[model samples]
Target: MEKANSSVPKPRKTSVLSNYEISVSIAFKRDCEVFLVEFAKQKTLSYAKFANIWQLKNMSYIFADQTYVSLLKTLCEECFAILTQCIIHQKNVYMKIGALYLLYGLYYKQPIEGMVKIRVSYDEYTIIKDLMDEMAKEKYMEPLFIFAKLKADVAFNYVGCSMPRSIRFIKNTKKAFTAHTLNANFGENPLSKFEGILQDESVVKLQDTCKRYEMALKKNSSIYPNIDQFKSTIMDDLNAAHKKLFSEDHSTPSEQIETDLKILNSRQEIKLRALKSENATYRGAKQVLTAIDLE
Candidate 1:
């Protein structure tokens, strides 16, 4: 009789997080209630705007809170999972960038006592690497590059080393390219000053965001041909409509002024209603409304 064939089973892959790690992650997420509440309250703010406002207005009180350092430390530990969920599951670019910003602040401001280590399983590492690659191909270049750079910084800092200058150089190049495109497109405007009053960083960060968006649009131009023409057409129509509405018909100066004021007020009210509806629909539309009450 022939000998029976024998086969050996492959070992199953396990999670990178240990039981302690899992427990700590759960506790940390629970502790994020305060952060979540703050986020929801200001969910309409852009990440940069929110960060700037928090730094100027609330940083001191937040630092004095007993749970602040602990929350930062927990976030540092769980940064990978948080970023992954934001990028992959939630598809929220702002949240992904926000999580990285939180991790970056934690690294600089509140240093942990001992060596804080992050260990990734082979499978998990592969998943992250693939995600980064996919984002790169999709022209989501800014966040993809930033996340990679930040992840390396977090990992190396935990082990008491600096990331190589070469990696930093590459990341900076990507950021500059996006920023340059935006600055060229928008030019300088008096409107930036108006935006600065509520959130000082909004204007600067908005330029950067616009550059990234412009690049994305250009990359997918085949699907959105005549976008620039469309914008010009809309602006021309708006200007013509405005001129028709406020045309001076040889009325008395005071009467003309009063009529103009009424037209402006009516237009402002319509804009405010539209802005509120937009805020309800989008995550950060309120920040776009310069006339909204920031208080």
Candidate 2:
């Protein structure tokens, strides 16, 4: 097996490459049966394989290059389907524990850009909440990677432009053009407070109209997202309140959404947001080294 190398020194906790990881790398090219036998006996293969898979140093190159599109395309549909099935079968505790480790390995090893759609669904708040809860419990070094990705996606993708009122050009236009009292005011619900529009009914009608137009535009103003585009699943699981509220809210202007998206898209800086900690920093520090150790 080829030993992993990087420009930076490996942190003390994650310094050595494990035998199971080496075997898995070997298995990636060679014999699966041999590796599985070793994995059962040692329990080390799973750990090392996963660790090697999500190694941050190796991912530095992808982050350095701007191949966002390439990264998105690399996600293997077949593999993701299998992973999702595994997640669905397990209990939440086991799911949270095992999935975080498994995903970290997959993420680090593959380092695919725009590849997050496979591991976890961002739209599913429960999945995000549980995974986060699990992370809060202990010194989970690996789960941090997924959390960073999620925060970046939320900050730049969901919270940033998804709300609409946060954009600059729209703010200026509202000031110059719209005299509607609500037009300039962004209410507490950032999504609803955009320029000159506040009535939920009016917003929903506008959104329905826009959805129609967007459908047309995609099909050269002819086609729309249809049954074929979606999986056959129960729509009943969707909350009616959310649907009603979504309908009532006017979309933040498309231009604003596009602009905010562009800002996130063009971002080159690495996104690093920490997960919430159950232990206070001092407590964590105390566990690491008692008063005598600092000296």
In angstroms, give how far residue 239 of model 2 lies from its true place.
Answer: 61
Assess the local accuracy of residue 255 in candidate 2 as a C-alpha lDDT between 0 and 100: 39
Residue 93 CA error for candidate 1 (Å)?
4.4
Least accurate 10 contiguous residues by lDDT in model 2: 174-183
Q: By lDDT, who's the top model here?
A: 1
Cα lDDT tens digits for candidate 2, 68-144: 44333323322232333334333433333344444444444455544544433454335555656666676554555
Q: What is the lDDT of residue 99 in candidate 1?
A: 42
RMSD of each: 23.7, 28.0
TM-score of each: 0.31, 0.26
lDDT of 1 by residue, 25-116 (tens): 55443333223333333444245444543453343342243355555454455643443333333233344344444444444444556634
Model 2 lDDT, residue 176, Cα:
21
Question: What global local distance difference test value does model 1 have?
Answer: 0.45
Best by TM-score: 1
